[model samples]
Target chain A: MKTYLLKWWQTIRISWSKYTAYRLNFFLQVVGPFLVFFFIKYNLWSSIYGEDTGQLIRGYNFDEMMQYHVWTLVISLLGQGYAAMNLSEDIRLGRISSYLIYPFEFWEFHTAGFLSFQILQIFVSSVTLGLAIFFGFLDLPSTMTLLHGFSFTFFMGFFWFTMQYFTGLLAFWLEETWIMRVLLSIVVSFLSGYIFPLELYPEWLVSGLKFTPFPYMSYFPAKIFMGVETNFMMGYAVLAFWMAVFAFVNHLIWKKGMRLYTAAGM
Target chain B: MSNKVIEVTNLTKQFKSYKKKPGIKGSIQSFFNREYTTKKAVHDFNLEINKGEIIGLLGPNGAGKTTLMKMFTGIIVPSAGELTINGHRPWERKKDFKKKIALVMGQKSQLWWDIPAMDSFLLLQKFYELSDQEFKTRLDYMAELLGVVDLLHVHVRKLSLGERMKMELMASLLHNPDVIFLDEPTIGLDLVAQENIREFVLDFHKKNGTTIIITSHYMADVQALCKRLVLIFDGTKAYDGPLEKFEKILGNEKTVSFSFSEEIGGCDFIDKYDAKWNECRNHVDIRVPEEELREVSKKILDLYPVIEFNTEKMPIERVMKTLMTNPEVLRQQRENLSS
Candidate 1:
């Protein structure tokens, strides 16, 4: 609808103000990781062979590893671009209850909000990531890749990002979700391939990851950039399977959670 | 066409409340004890509201007023009941249903707290998916009516309470909802702010026949805007009737107050007249017996040089406090918890 497009545009116009409200924090957020990743990649390459040498292992020579780390670091910026709070916060603060009185469906409104934030995140993070990559502090094997790796990353990010949303459902029942948040980091680091690449992991872990969506978010796409793209059809198959799994699981939890959700003050 | 826009049958809500023990040890023990409490928040309540009707839901704290509103909005599921709004079940939360309803709470803000109100309005436009012409027309009208067009550019956080409330009214009415839920919309605001909102609400109803269901601890809100009231005392429908009937039944008899220049103890005239009285440092306050207030006031004025005197009745706040806490009423209230 023309109205809908106008509305979406209006939503983004104020995003600059929201983003600028925490300019210092946002800039620091980008730069902090930028510096850390640069040092880590440099140290990794040097430590692999000798002080003067480059490369990590057999397949990944010094040049390749250096490039890979730089690229991955830029990629990691996408994840941090997200500004999200648990869905439970909406319930806890009575915002969800207010939304209910409106004519719109709850999930539809939430989806709109989610889509809005994601668009904003992608825009802001891409700028930051591009800058980081341009500075030559971080590098990844490009292979002149256009949409190959990027497109896969997009699907993987969506599939895994939804998992975070479902995890938001846990807040309905749990008095405190601190433990869940901590454990979530481990899951993200493990499967999203933040700490280690999927190929570098033990064979059993890599195989096991295939069953979950986390690797699609971080690891699979990282490999694609390293010239290790999966079979396109197989990748789509796995992506579709994870999407279905996440959707089914999320729907199930949401249906059950609504019955139990007080949407009242905690 | 029938005037009724809201209909309900035996509406009930029961929320699960997890009990907590005091200390860490008690918490561990409770895990083993497996204790939980189920609170019956709203019970078997039935009502029919016509379009253009503004009804007040009056209760003390935790009286299930908010819960009832939430149910109508389809935010909270009722434990057992049937509720329909404009012929649609509220819980279905259909697009038509959403377009016709709006909710606002005074204590909580729907406006994005950090951004200017205009920004928040823009987001609301998307949520409601209003056409540009429709959005602009409504925005202009609401701003004109509420006198908040200039204020829109200011951040909501920077605005005063009254300004924020004005903006809130505009935001809620952006879609021109046919049904409005006001949960303490005037709470914690100054008298001026309260009056402004009340005026806007009354005018809104007059113009659009928007059925309004308002809950507030402030009885003035009810007194000024609502003719019929549903009083929920302790999570149950304690009283449901006309405002005049509620006042008459709940002993809405006027109480006169006077402040003497000195610390005067008890009033002998009050004793003689059998009038209930309170004396605290230079003030002699009396709850005028239903029939004898004016006659007694005359005699008092003749007897003592009353430094300050008013024949006005006691405030609604005091009336409800006494009604809820009195010993005889408390016993009766508990027995008929929900009917």
Candidate 2:
């Protein structure tokens, strides 16, 4: 446990240094999504309400609609690296081989590394979120009220990170991993409500998606921030269950895959 | 007392199949029916290495030298072998097993590429939980022994091949493992650098009394550091014994060539010396047993026909080639060729 803590501390140190060194790119990663969604919001509103459309949107003024878009963008930050395919890269380069030889559990290293990267993400996301708050562009509740929303996002982020690692390990079995990643992206995009609200889905589809690990990735975070009228407790329970399942499944696959790990060399 | 630091009884590892053939048709067909090909990499290997002994594993490519090394290091499991290293089954990956040994591959650098090599050394120091004083003492000792003190501050990518290798050797030894597995330590090094490494390995073994297992393409490394070697071919042991005995089994015979000024060769002269006229113009080749080489060379020079001549030890390449194919050699050494 002491070694594990030390290693995690080291990983955080490295990531913190990397984040500071590449400050501009880290900032751009957060801000880039805001700009993207702003235009997307403008286009959607113009289509629905016409040229004379007031800043009002979805029955709210232009500010409200823009705020919704920005909220969704900030929520989407939780899903970014989960879909980035870092583990698949590790598998190809045989970087994972180094972990296999060590005494630590592979998942422990993955989690610690992810946590460090997420530590950096917190700063980047906060800046973007802070900007929205400053411009009166987002409706953040008082610190006490937003605490519930923050916890919801943190657990969901943790769950999604584990699931993402499990999905990436599938690259060991797949020949061309892009196909699997695309299929996963489509599922997450539609089911988790990255593009739209989960409530927008029909009754059966929304219920079915509630069973998937994807909602813990994007939908719950969005719901928390937007104060989407739903059972937050229900979402958290479902996220916890999926996290346990992903952990169990990841353990099973890793145990089986190790028997097949034909390490690359002459 | 434990007489052996490493003991094995028929250790074998057969890798399972997981990579599917590409194509839509094949993928669909294989969804219902799966095929597996188990490659038995290390097969029925048995040996007992005592403490402080140096063992050399020799083989052609794909002869399972590395497979044995990996199994010993706990990186891979054996399919059908009972082995113990430092009273532990290596595959168990116990902290004790990890602390007892370090594995180094010649062409691979475990040093962090972007950072100074000392950082990696420091990490390993922390990893092994060495005390600050102990770490410094061992670090200084290894750096001095391996001649890498000057290269510690340089990034691994900036160091030359020899300098990086020296650093690697120093890093692995920093923990003072009871055993060290070197897979091709002298590869990609010049003759001088190879000699330096060879000398370090020998002196390290003598000083630390650490058992060593080295697999390399350079036979000179084996001849210099290891008196005994285990030769594996096609995933099985071909020969195991002292270097001189293996060389004798190899029949280190020599072929001497004499270049005559004139192509006028006669059978009368050839028969006296038992020389054969090879395809070379004005060149006569003679095969002499290693013991009789001196007498034959003296007699050949005394003959009037000789113009210029040179005697050389048989090349190891040809000797191994002949040894692998010789019916007599196989009959004497009844080891299976395919594991």
Candidate 3:
């Protein structure tokens, strides 16, 4: 256990160095996308609420809706991409052989790499949040809400990581996973409340999304921060279940995939 | 605690690759009726490696050197037969099994491309569960030997290929693995770098008694480090024995090259000796038996005003070309010689 922890810590240190190596690129990556989305969300929401100041669309006032947009944007900026892409690239290009010779397991190594990346993301998100507050685009949440929101957001981020990992593992069999990548983007954007609030969707659409893990990644965390009544335990339960499912499936796929790997091109 | 660290018997790995037809209709037809061909990458291979031995795996491209190495390293499973490294089934992939082995692929890198070499070394140290003192001692020793102690902080991407390869060696050896697998470790290095790596490998093995297996296109690497050679051709073992024994079977042939002081028309002596002439360099080469090298040189000197004359072992490229084209004749020669 101590060895594993040491390995994880070293992974973070290495990844942190890589993240900070290109300081200009790292800062621009976060700031550039955050600015673009902030303006778009702010403009779209202002146009909607400008025509009807008294309208209570989906139980959100103008201030509350703006708050949702800011936090949601923050969470999206800090989100992890499908690491399976890296995994697949490694396998297809024969780099996986290097890892196979090591004492560490494949999934564990990639997971440590992903975790290290998120550690950097969390740091970036904090800086972005500070920027948002300074720019007068976001008001600080209450102490209690901040605690609940961070906890939920952490699990939400993990859930998304697992899902992305599971989806990326398809590269073990399929040579090309771009279609799946595109599909994931469409599904997450439409269902994870990244583009719009889940409350804006119809009753049937919301009901269908409840069966998936997308909304737990973005919507519930935002709703919890607003101090709105959410089924916190239930959301946690679903996230935990998906995490378990993805873990088991990933293990099986890895075992089976090891047999299929050709380590092409030496 | 056997002296033999690796043992294999009848090991074979077969890869199934499907043919891709051209155009949409061909693709559809092929998809429906997939024509998969089974490529036998490693065919009934057998090997036994002892402690403190450096063995060279020699072969042409796509001749199963890398595949066999992959199987030994537990990257891919063999379709049939048995393999054991350090008394562990390679495909089982036990942590203890992996802890004892290191693989350095020349075409690929294990270091983090965007991070400093030191960072990758630190991660490897933790992954190998080494104490800080042990890690530091090993890293310092290897870095000093490879002359990369100061370059450790430089990003791997920014380093030269040879520099990165040095770091790779340091990273692989930090844990003192019992068995080291090197696949073309000197692929793209200059002569000086290659010799440095060769000397380092010899020094490291001398100190540590690590069993080593290396594959390379450069014969200098094989000649410098490996006493034993495993020659594979067409995905099968063509020859396995000491380097001296294999050379003896090829009749101890040497390439004798000559350069005349002035360009001359083709001489009857050249035709009589069946020499190959390079008109551009005013050079001529003749194949001579090792026993007759002195006589041949003397005769050539007497005939022509020779400015330069040298005798070299048959080039490994030529050796491999002959082996690939006439495996049966080589095998017969070996059998006859042994008998």
Candidate 4:
């Protein structure tokens, strides 16, 4: 157990240093694109609500609607873009062979590396939030709301990471997974409420989506920060269930994938 | 470890792959009716590698040298037959089994590319659960031996290929594995760099008595490190014995060259010897059996005042070329091995 933790710690340190080696590239890849994306969403939301100060569409005043989008940006930065691409690339190129001979498992190494990247992004996300507050474009949530929302979003991050890993495991059979990545991006954006809020959808659709893991990804945590009505217990339960399901599926895929890898020299 | 560290019997690996037809219609047809072929990468291979021996795996491309190495290192599973390294089944991939061996492939890097080599070494230390003192001692010793102590702090991508390869060796050796597998370790290196790597490997082997299996296209690597050779062809073992035996088994033709002080007054000697003349009229080369070397030299000297004359075995490249292209000789050798 001590050795496991030590290896993971070293993985984090080494991976973080690797990611930060190109400081400019890190900012451009992580910060620049997301900032542009957020602005585009901001403009689209503004156009929808119009210039009126009293606009309240779907129980969200203009300020609250913009805040929802801001939180989506935060959640996207904190919880999305898992290590699927790198994982799939390694599998496809047979580079994973080099690591298979090592004492540690492949998934553990990648998970620790992904966690390291996300941990650094947490600091980046905080700075973005601080800048938003300073610009008078955002309001801080209450202490109780902050605690609940953070814990929810943190767990959701891991849930999303597992889902991404599940997608990456398809590379053992598929030569290229860019199509799957594209499909995943579209599904995540539409279902996770990154494109719009669950309230904007039909009542049946909203009820159905609540049963899925999507709302817990962007809507639940962002709502807590918006001081909107929320079912924290229900959110936690759904996220945990889906996380367990994904984890089980990821493990199955990993077992079968390793067999195929060893058999065929992938 | 016992003397017999590695044993294999009728080990085989066959890869199943589909052939893609060209064009859009063919692509659709392939999706519907893909034709799969099973190419045997390693076929009925058998060997026994003793401890503390350097064996060269020699073969043409696609002859399953790398496949066999991968099987030995536990990176790939054999489709059939039994294989044991240090009495452990390779496909089990036990952590203890892995701790006893290390593999280095010239085409692939195990080091983190963007980070300093030292950082990767530290991660490996943790992976192997090496104590801080043990890790530092091995790392320092290997780094100094390879003359790479200063390059360890530089990013791997920024270092030259030779420097990076040295670091790779250091990383693999830090835990002092009992077995090492090197696949094309000297590929794409200059003469000096290749010699340096070869010398380091020799020194390391002499000191530690580790069992090593290396595959290289460079004969110099084979000549410098390995006394025994295992030659495979067409996915099967063709010959396994001392390196010198390869010359006797494959072919026995020796080249005898003669350089004269002045051009021969007459060209009649060429007809008697069937010699090929160099562009300069003074030099001639004749191929003869090893037993006729003295007779051929005496005859040549009777005709001309030889400034210099020499007899040497055929170059390894020529032998390999003949072996790779001719199926008849390879089949005969395989039959010999079986018998």
Off by over 4 Å in 2: A1-4, A14-61, A78-84, A92-94, A131-136, A139-141, A211-213, A226-232, B16-35, B107-116, B140-171, B189-193, B252-287, B299-318, B324-328, B333-339
Q: Per-residue lDDT of B98-131 in model 3, one digit per residue for the tens?
A: 8999999888889889988888888899999999
RMSD of 3: 2.4
Model 2 pairs in collision: A55-A61, A55-A62, A56-A60, A56-A61, A56-A62, A57-A60, B12-B79
Task: Tell how far residue B302 is off in model 1, in angstroms.
Answer: 4.5
lDDT of 4 by residue, A1-266 (tens): 99889999998888889778997987776667447755797778778878785778888887778788888878877878555568888888887886778898888888988889788888877877776677666878788887777777788888888888888889999878889989988988888888888889899988998879998888878887777847789888998899899999989998888777842333
Q: Order of all candidates by DockQ, from best down to worst?
A: 3, 4, 1, 2
For model 4 chain B, give the 10-residue run with minimal summed lDDT.
B312-321
- For model 1, what is the alpha-carbon lDDT of residue B179? 89
Please write out the lDDT profile of model 2 over residues B1-339, one tens digit for every residue. 987999999888887664466899788767877887788888788898888888889887787998888888877778887999989998787877788798777866666676678877776675666778988998888788777888888778889999899888877787789999998988899998999999988888888899999998887888788878788877877778777776656454677777776664465644555577766447777777788788877875776467889864435445566765663575455543343
Q: List the residue pairs that clash in candidate 4.
A: none
Error of 4 at A12 (Å): 1.0
Estimate, for each residue in B66-94, the C-alpha lDDT of model 1 and write its tens digit: 88888888777888989988888878778
Residue lDDT tens for model 4, B153-265: 89899988988888888888888999999989988988898998999999999989999999999888988899899999878988788877776666566777889998765
lDDT of 1 by residue, A1-266 (tens): 77655554655555546655667876776466656766775676666667634444746666656655655655555542343353557755656666665544455555555555556556655665666568764453454663677666666556655666666667777745557766886777766667656667788977877766666666566667767675656666787787788788889987887788776661
| Model 3: CA > 4 A from native | A78-85, A135-138, B262-272, B277-283, B302-304, B313-317, B334-339
Look at candidate 4 and tell me the lDDT of residue B146: 83
Q: Pick the candidate with the highest TM-score.
A: 4
What TM-score would you report for chain A in candidate 1?
A: 0.80
Q: Candidate 1 chain A: minimum summed lDDT over ten consecutive residues — where? A: A77-86
Query: Of the candidates numbered 1 and 3, which has the greater TM-score value?
Result: 3
Second chain alone, TM-score for each candidate: 0.86, 0.85, 0.92, 0.91
lDDT (Cα, tens digit) per residue for candidate 3, span A157-193: 7777777777777777876677888888788887888
